[model samples]
Target chain A: MESNRRKFLKVAGISALGIAGAKPVLNAFASEQEEEAQHADVEIRKNEKALTARQWAMVIDTRKLQSEEDLKPIIEACHKTHNVPDVMDTENAEYDEDNQRHVIKWIWEEEYKHAFPTKSTEFLDDRLKNLPFLVLCNHCENPPCVRVCPTKATFKREDGIVLMDFHRCIGCRFCMAACPYGSRSFNFRDPREFIKDEDRNPEFPTRMKGVVEKCNFCAERLAVGKQPACVEASNGAIAFGDLYDPESEVRQLLKSNYTIRRKQGLGTGPAIYYIV
Target chain B: MLELTVKGSKKYFGWMALVLGVIGIGFCVYVWQLISGLQITGMSRDVSWGFYIAQLTFLVGVAASAVMLVIPHYLHNYKAFGRITILGEFLAIASVTMCLLFVIVDLGQPMRLFNVILHPTPGSVLFWDMVVLNGYLFLNLIIGWNVLEAERNQVPPPGWVKPLIYLSVPWAVSIHTVTAFLYCGLPGRGYWLTAILAPRFLSSAFAAGPSLLVLLCLLIRKISKFDPGKEQIQSLAKIITYAIILNVFFFFCELFVVFYSQIPEHMDHFKYLFTGLHGHGVLVPWMWASLGLMIFSIIMLVIPSVRKNETTLAIACIAVFAGTWIDKGMGMISGGFVPNPLHHVNEYVPTVPELVITIGVYGIGVLILTALFKMAISIKEEVAA
Candidate 1:
C-alpha cells in the first residue's frame, strides 16, 4: 500500500510537468490557427478597399505664373482656407518693409531680383522687369529645418510630405532660424483668437501659443487619398503627381522643362520644382 | 563674505554712482520690458538674434578676461598679479552677471527658461550655453569668494581650492569659445560659419576684454586709492598688443577668403557688413570704424613710446573695447540676417523698449560691479593695513 502511494505521487508530479509544458504549445497552435483565419479575412477585404500607394510631388510652371495676377488666387485661397487672419501688427511683420502685419502668406510673390541675385534682367522690358513667380515651401527630401528641429516636431511622412506636429513644439524658434526659406511661423499669441469657429479646419491642428507651426502639405487629406488643398485650389497652376512615375504630370514636366528651386545652390534638393 | 565700509572720511564714489540716480530711474523704465515681450526689440524672424545676444557675446568675452590675470598669477607664478588678481576675479563676476542679465532681459520668454533644465534637449546648443554660462558664473564666484575670504583671514586657501583656481584657467577660455560656437554652428549664415571663428573670438576677447580690464583698473584708481601699478598696466598692454595683432590677422583672413573666393553667400555678408548691400549701408560705417579703431589701437600698443604713456594706452584700450564691441555686437548679428538667402534685407535697429531694457540690465551690472568693487577695494586696503 505504501509503495503504491509513493508511485502515485511521482506519477502525479510528472503529469503536472507535462501539462505545464504542453499548455504553451497548445496556445501557440491556437494563435497560429487564428492568424491564418485573420490573414484570409484580410486578403478578402483588401480587394474592396483598393489601397493604392501614392507619393506626392508638386510642379509649378512659372510660364503659367507669367504675371503676379496668376499667383494671387492661389495665395489668397491658402490664406483663406487656413484662416490665417490678416496680421494686425503689420508694423512688426518680418517681411513687411512698413512693418505692418498682414496675412501670413504661404505663397510669396517672388521675382528675378528676389529669387536669383546672380541673374540679371537688364535687357528685359518694363513688363518683364520683375516677372513675379509664386514661391512656397519646397518640402525638400533632406530638409535643413527638419534636421535641426530639437523637438522632432517637424518630420517627413512616407508620402513625401514634411509635416509639423505643433503639439510637440516648445517654440524655441530654432526651426525658424534654421529654415532658409522662412517657411515656418511662431504662433506669438493664441492663434485661435484670430481664427473663427467656422474657419477652423479639423484636419490641421490649431496651434497653441509658444509653438512653431508650418505648412504640412495637408497630409490628413493625402491619407484619405485626396490631393493637397493648395494644389487642388490652384486652378491647374500647380501640377500634382508622383515624381517617381515617369509618365506622371510632375515627372514629365520635370523631364521636359528646365526647372529651378528658390535656392538651388543651397543643395537642399527640393522635391518641388518651378519651371521658368 | 562682502562687507560695506563707508567711513565718513573716505570719499566714497559709490555715492556718486548712486548720484547718477536719473540714469538708474531711466534704467527702471527700460526694465518694464518684461511685461512687453521681445516685440519691443529690433529683432524679427529673419534677424532672430540681435542686441541682447550681441551684448551677451561681448560680456562673455569680458568675463573671460579674468583668464589673463589667472594665467599669469597661477600658472606662470607672476606675483605682480597677486595684489590685483582678486580685482580681475571680481570684474569677471560682475561681467558674467551682466552677461546672464542681458540674456534674460533679451529672452522672449524669461519665465520659461528653467524648462531648458527640466526638459533638457541634448541637441540644442542653447541648452549647453545655459550650462556653460551658469557653470562659469558659480566657478568664478566660489573661487573669488574663497580666495578673498582666505586673504581676509591672512592665510593661504586650503590645498583643494588651488585645483579649482587651476581649473578656472581653461574654463574661462571655454566660456568665450562656447559663445563663438553659438554663432559659428549655424549652417546657412555664411558670415560666421568658419573654423577660425572660435580663435578670432578668443583673440578679440584677449584684445578687448583685457583692454576693458585696464580701463576698469584706471576707473578704480580714479574712484579709489588702489594703484595696480605701472608695471602691471604695461604687462596687460603688451598682452593686448599681441592679442590685437592676432585679431586683426583673423579679420584679414576672413576678408581674403570672402573676397578671393567671391562665393556669393559668404561674400554678400561681408559686403553687407563692410560696403553695404541692397540699400542697407547703415552698418558699413560702423564696421569700418571698428576695423580702423582696431588697427589704430594695435599700432599704439605695438609702438613702445605710445605704450609707455598712460593717456595713449588708455585711449588705445578704450578704442579697442569700443571697436570690438561694435564689431561683435552690430556687425556679427546683423551681417548674418541681411541679404538672406531669399535676397531679403531685414534691417535690425533696437527699439525704445529694447534700448530701455538693455540699459536697465546694464545699469544693474554696473550697480553690481560698483558695489562689489567698493567692498573688494576696502578689504584690500584693510589687508594692506
Candidate 2:
C-alpha cells in the first residue's frame, strides 16, 4: 500500500509539471486564434457593408485628365474648399529670382514623367507622355507619416483615411520627410496672410503658421454623406470607395483597368491608383 | 559647486560674457521666430528640416560619445580614464542640453511640445527618440554628478550608482540608434532607408565623440591644473581610428550595394551628393570636402608618430570631428530630402536668423560645458593637492 502511494505521488507531480509547462503554450495558441478571428471579422464586415469598411481608397482615371485644363477644376475645388493658402508672392532671396519658396499645395498637378517616374518609358505614347496627372496624398495603407508624427496630429481613421488634426500639428515636418508622395505642405509663414479674406472658405478652418497640413480625404464631407470635393468635381473621373470591399467601386475600377500606383514597389501600399 | 565657476580668471569671465551676449541675441531672435513663425528661417515645404535638425543630429553623437570614456573606465576597468571620464560626461550634459534646445526651436509650435509626452504613441520613432534622449540626459546628469561628488569626497560611489553607470553604456548606444531610426524607418527616403544606418551612426558617433573628448582634454590641460593624461588621449585616439575606419567602410558598403545594384532610387541621392543630379549639385563641393577631410585624418591617425604627437593628434581630431559633423549632420539630413518623393531637387540654405540661432545654441552648450568643467576641474585639483 505504501509502495502504491509513492508511485501515485510521482505520477501526480509529473502531471502537474506537464500542465504548468503547457499553460503558456496553450494561452499563446488561444490568443493567436483570437487574432485570426478578429481578422476574419474584419473581412466579413468589409464584404457586408462596402462603404462602412475600415479601409478608404481612391482611384484616379488619368485617361480622363487629358490636359492642364482638365486638372484645374478638381485642384481648385480642393484648394478653395479647404481654404489652402496661396503663397505666390512669398519669395526666398537665396534661390533664383523665379524660384518661389513659399508655394504651398495640398493637391496639385504634375506631368506624367514626374508623377509616374518608375513606370515611365521612352516607348510610351506621346499623348500619354504629355498628359498631366492630378496627384495628392496616397493615404497609404501603412502610412510613414503617421508612424513618424511625434504628436498624434496626423492619424489614420478607422476607415483608413489619413486625416490631419491641424490644431495638434507641432509642425516638426518629420511627416513631410517620411511621406514618399510629397503630398504634405508646411506653412512657411502665417497662411492667414496669404489667404484672401474674401476667398477663404468659412466652413473649413485655415491653418496657422508653423503647422503641417495635407489632404485629409475630406473626412468632414464623408462624415456628412457627401463625396470628397475633388471626386465631386471630377464627375466620375475619380472613384472614391472602400478598398477592402471586393465589390466596391474602387475595387471594380482597379479590376477593370490596368492601374498603377506611384512608388508601389516601395511596399507602402498606396491607396491612390492611377488608371493609364 | 556654484562658487567654483566664479573663481576663474579675467579671460574666463570675458569668455562667459561673450557666450552670454550671444545667448542674449539668440533669445531676441527666438522671440522673433516665435512671433513670426518658421518663415524667418530658410526652410521650405520641400526641405523641411535644415541647420537646426542637422546640429541636433551631430550633437546627439557628441552626447553619445561619453560612452567611449564610460566603457573603458567602468566596464573594462581601465583606470587611466578615471580623471577623463568626468570630462566626457560633462561634454555629454552640454551637448544633450543643446540637442533638446534645437528640437524646441525647430518645432512649429514649441508650446505643444508636451503633446508628445501627454499623448504617447509607442509606434512613432520621434516618440522613442524623445524618450531615449531625455532618458540619456538624466542618466548622464545623475551618473556624472554622483561620480564627481564621490570623487570630491574621496569615497567610492554609492552602490546604486554603479548599475546606473553600466546602464548608461547601452543607453548611450540606444540614444544614437533611436536617432538614426528617426531617418532610417522612413519608407520613401531612399538615402535614409537602410538597415545599416543605426550601425553607421554608432560607428560615426564612436569616432566623433572620442575625437571631441580628446580635444577637450587638451583644452583642459592648457586652461587648468587638471591633466587628462597622455595615455588616456592615446587610447582615445586609437578608439577614434578604429571607429572612423569602420564608419568609412560601412559607407563604402552602402555605396557598393547602391551602385552595384543599379537601382535608381538607391543611386539617386548618391548621384546628387557626389555628382549633382539633374544639374543641381549644390552639395557636391561640401560632400567632397567632407570626404577629403575624413581620408586625410584617417591617414594621419593610422600612423603611430602622427597619432602620438599632441599637435598632430589635435589636427587629426579636428579633421575627424569636422568630417563626421558634415557627413552626419548636413549630408545625411539634407541628402535624404533631395530627389524628394517626386524626384525633384530643391536645395536648402540656412538664412541669417537660422545661423544666428544655431550659434546661440552652440554658445549655450559651450557655457554649460564651461561651468560643469569648472566645478569638475576645481574638485580634481583640490583632490590632487
Candidate 3:
C-alpha cells in the first residue's frame, strides 16, 4: 500500500506541474488567435454611431456666397467651436488690420484677388471679382505642414484630415512657414486670455499660447456623427464628405460643378475646392 | 587648461563684467518673453519668423565656415592654415552655441524641446537640422579641446582624433546644407525655394566667416606678439574675395530668374526687399546699403596691395562682415515672408526688447569666444616661449 501511495503522489505532482505550465501556453495561443482575428488598431476608437470616411474633402460654393453678410454665421460657428481668439481685444474686430501681428484665424473671408492671386485678372467680371471667397486649411494630401513638423505634433489622419495636437507642439512655427495657404496661425500670446467666457465651447479643447493651430475640419463633431460646424452653419454653401467615395455628396458636388483649388500647380493636392 | 581663462589682466575682467551684465539683462527680458509670450517680439502671423531665426541662419553659415580652414589645412596640405584652424573650430563652437540659444528663444514651447528627440521623424528637414547642428557642435568641442590640449602638452592629438577631424569636414557642410533645406524645401516662400539656396548659403558663409577670422587675427596681433602670419591673412583675403564674388553671382542668378520669368510670386519678394512694395518697405535702404558694401569689399579685397596691407584688409574684412550680415543675416529670413502666402505685404521689424535680446545672445557668444580664444592664445604663447 505504501508503494502504491508513492506512485500516486508522483503522478499527481507531474500533473500539477503540467497544468501550471499549460496555463501560459494556452494564454500565448489565445493572444495569437486574438491578434490574427482582428487588427490591433480595430481595438481603438470604437463608436458604433460615429461617421466614417475614406478621405475628407470640402467644397466651398462661391455661387452660394450671396453677400459678405452670408459669411458671418459660418465664421462665427467655426471661431466659436474652435475658440479662435480675437487679438484685437474687441469683439467685432474680424476685419481689423491694426494688430495683424497677432491675427489668429480658423476660417475667414478673402477677396477674389487675394484668394486666387494667380487666377485673378485686372479686368475680371465685376461680380466674380467683388464676391467674398471663403478660405481655410486645404488639408492637403501631401501636407507640407505635416512634413515639416519635427515633433509629429501635426499629423494627417488616415482619412486624409490634417490635424494638430496642441499639447505636443513645440511652437517652432516651421509648420506655419510650410503651409502654402496661410492657413496656419501661431499664438503670439495666451489664447485663453483673448477668449470670452460665453464664447468658450466646452466640447472643444481650448488652446494654449506658443502652439500652432488651424482648421481641423470638425473631426470632433464627425466622431459624434455630425457634420463640421461651418458646413452646418453655411446654409448649404459648404459641402463636407468623403472625396474617395464616388456616391458621396461631396463627390457629387465635385462632378456637377466646375471647381478649382488654390495653388494647384504647387502639387500639394489641396482638398478645399471652390465651386466657381 | 581652464586656468588659462582665470588669469587675465584687468581689461579681461572688465570685459567679463560687461558680458555678464548684458546676459543678466537678457535673462530678465527672456523671462518676460516666457511669461508674456512672443507678443513681446516683432514677429507676426504673416512674418512668422523674424530676427532670432535670421541670426541663427547666419550663424549656421559662420559655423560651417570652419570647413574652409579645415579643407585647406587637412586635405590640400596648405600649412599656413594649420595655426588658425583651432581658432576656426573655436569660433564654430561659439557660433553653434549662439545658434542653439537663438533656436531656444525662438521656440514657443522651449520646455518641450526634447519632443524632437523623443518623437524623431526622419522625413522632416528640421529633425535633420537639429541632428546636424548638435553633431557639428559636439565634433568641434571634442576636436578643438583635444587639439589645443595636445598643443599645450607638446604631443600629437591621440590617433582617434584624426578620424573625427576628417569626419568634421563633411559634417560642417551638412549643417549648412540642412539649414538651407529648412528654407528651400518650403513650397510657398519664393525667396527661399531655389535649388541654389544651399550653394548661395555656403558662398556667403565662406565670405563672412573667413573675413571675421581676418579681423580676429588682426585683433590678436594687437594683443599679442604672435601673428597668424601675413601669408595666411592674404590667403584668407583671397578666399573671402572669391566667396563674395560667388555670393553676388548667385544673388544675380536668382534675380534673373525672378525678373526674367516675370513670376509675380518670385519677383514680389525681391521688390519688397530692394524697393518699397506697396509704399511700405523699411528694408529698402538697408538692402541697397548691403549691396553697396558688398561691391566695395569685393573691389578692395580683389586688389593685391589692398588685401596685403594690414589696414586696408581690416577695413575690407569689416565691410564683408557687415555686408554679409545684412544680406544673409537680416534680409534672407524676413524677405521670404514679405508678400506673405496670401500675397499680403506685412513687414516685420524687431522691437526694442527683441533687439536687446538679440544683442544679449551676441554678448554671450562673444563671452564664450573670448574665454576659448584666451585659452588657445595662452597655450600658443607658452609654446612660443
Candidate 4:
C-alpha cells in the first residue's frame, strides 16, 4: 500500500512536470493510468460468473411473503453472510439504555406503518395494516449519503450499490445523518465482540467499532457471480436484477405488478420497491 | 505580550489553576472515550450525534459572534466598540478552539480526521464547515494578534489586516451558514429540512455569542484595571435584544408551519421534543425551561429601562446564553434524531464520561479565554498609562 501511494505521488509529480512541458503528454499519461486501474479491477474479478448490471434493484413482493416467519431466513442469510453483529444477544450489552437503539442490521423487517410512514394510514386493510416490509439501503439514484460523506467512504458504485470502504471510513457518521431511510448503522462498540465464531463468515470481513456500516446490496457476492444471500434465501419473495435491463427480473416484476418506493416525494429514486 | 499573561493577580492565577484542574480530569476521561469508542456517549445508531456535536454547533455561533463587534467597529467606525472588539476577537479564538476540539472528540476515527483534507471533498457540507472554521480561526488569530501587537508597539496595524478584517465580516456568517448546511440539506430529517435553518442558526448565534461577550465584558470590569465601558455594554445589549427577538420569531414561524400543516413527519419531531412522542420525554422539561428562559430574557431586554441597567442586563444575558444553549445546542440535534428516520423514539442523554469530557472541553476554552483576556487587558492598561 505504501509503495503504491509513493508510486502514485511519483506519477502525479511527473504529470505536474509534464503539464509544464506538453499538454498532450499529460493527457496520454492520465489515460494510461486509467487503463491500468481498469486492468487491475479485471485481474481482481477473475470469476467468470460475476453478475453484471447497469443499475441494480430489488423487488419485495408481499404476496409471496405470507407471514413474519417467511422473513426470518431472508434476514438470517444476509446477516450471517455479512457478519452483522447480533447486538441484543451480547452479554452485558445492557450498557445501552435501550439495546434496540444500538442494534445493527444490514437488512431487517420494519412494520408497514413505520416503513412507509408517509404512506401509512390507520384504516388500511387489516392484512396491509400489520404487514412487515423489508427495509435496507435504498441504493438511491441520488444518494444523500454519498453527497454528504466528507471522506467519500460511503459511496455509490457504478452498478448502483451504495458500498462502504471500511478501511477509508473516518466514522464521522455524517452519512448516517444524511441517510433518509434509517438504513445506515454506526458501530457504537466493537462489532466483532458480538458475532459468534460459528456464525461469522470467513469470506466476509467484520467491521470495527466506531465506523458506520449498512447494506451494500451484497456487492461481494455479486462480484463472485452469485445472487445476494437474501435473494437466494427469500424463496422468490424477493427478486433482484438490473433495473435498466427490461428483460431482468426486477423490471419484469415492476412492469407486471403495482409497486411503491419509500419516500418517493423526496426524489431519492430508491432502487428497493415494495409490491403491495 | 506573552509575559503579560504569565504575570497576573492571585485571583487570576487561582482561576487559571481551577481551569487547568478541570482540563486534567477531562483529558483523562477523553482518553477513556478514545479507547472505548462512542459507546460511552448517549448516542446510538438512531441518534448518531449527541452532546459533542451539539457543543460544536453552539460554539461556532459563539465564534461567529465576533463579527457583531467587527461590523460596528470597522464598518461603521463606532468608537465605543473599539475598546471591546479585541475582547470579541480573542473570545472567538477560544470558542473556535473549543469547536475544533468538540469535532475531534465526536469523531469515531479522530486519527483519520485529515482524510477530509486528504480526500478534498468539496461536495460535502462537512468539508466546507471544516474549511470555513479553520479559516475563521486563522483569520482571527492573525487579525487579533497583529492588531494587538501593533498597539503594544505603539504603531499602526499593518495594511494587510484591514482587508482581512473586512473579509472576516462575511467569513463569520459563512462559518455558521456552512454549519447549518450540514443539517438543512439532509434528505429525511424533517426538523432540519427547513430553509430558514441557516437564518435561525445565525440569529441564535448573534444573540448567544453577544450575550456571552456581554458577560465576559462584565467579568473584565469587575476584575481588571481597564473597563470594557458601559456604552459598549449597552450597545451589545441592544444587539442581543434584537437578535434574540429575531431568533424567537423565526422559531415560532417554524412551529406554525410544523403544527398548522400537521405534517406528522415534521410535527412529530416537535411533539417528541416539546411534548414527548411515545412515553419518551427526557428532553421535554429541558426544552420548556429553555423556552421559558428565552421568553423571560426577551421581556427583560425589551424593556429599555431594564436594558440600560447593568444588573438586569447581565441577568438577561445569562438567560440568553443558557436559553440558546439548551434550544440550539441541545434541542436542535436531539430533536432532529429522536424520531429517527423510521419514526422511532430512541432517547439520548449524555453519559457521565461524555458530560465530563464536555466540561473538560469548556474548561480548556475558559483557560484560553482567560489568557487572551489577561493579555488584552494588560495591553489596554499599558496604553492607558
Among the numbered candidates, top DockQ falls to: 4
Cα deviation in Å at residue B284, candidate 3? 0.6
Descending-DockQ candidate ranking: 4, 3, 2, 1
When candidate 3 is compared with the true two-chain complex, its DockQ is: 0.62
lDDT of each: 0.74, 0.88, 0.91, 0.91
Q: Which whole-number lDDT from 0 to 100 does residue B67 have in model 2?
A: 94
Candidate 4 is scored at a TM of 0.93
- Pull out the clashing pairs in model 3: none
How does model 3 fare in lDDT? Answer: 0.91
Over B115-200, each residue of candidate 1 has an lDDT whose tens digit, in order, gives 56545666666667777888888888888877877787799977878989988998998988887877677666788888889889
Per-residue lDDT for A1-276 in model 1, tens only? 965885698689879999997886688679879999889867443333221234567898766666767777777667666655555534455545423321244666766667655554567566446678666777877677766554466777776677776656555566666667767665544556667777676655665555556666656555566676768767777888777778888888888889776666667667777776
TM accuracy, model 1: 0.81
- Compared with the true structure, model 2 gives a TM-score of 0.90
lDDT of 1 at A38: 88
List candidate 2 stretches off by more than 4 Å: A1-53, A89-99
> Candidate 1's error at B65, in angstroms?
2.1
Model 4 C-alpha lDDT per residue in residues B198-225, reported as the tens digit of each score? 9999999999999999998888888888
**Residue by residue across B265-312, what tens digits does model 2's lDDT show?**
879999999999989988898899888988999999999999999999
Task: Give the deviation of candidate 2 from the true structure as CA RMSD.
Answer: 11.3
* Model 4 residue-pair collision total: 0
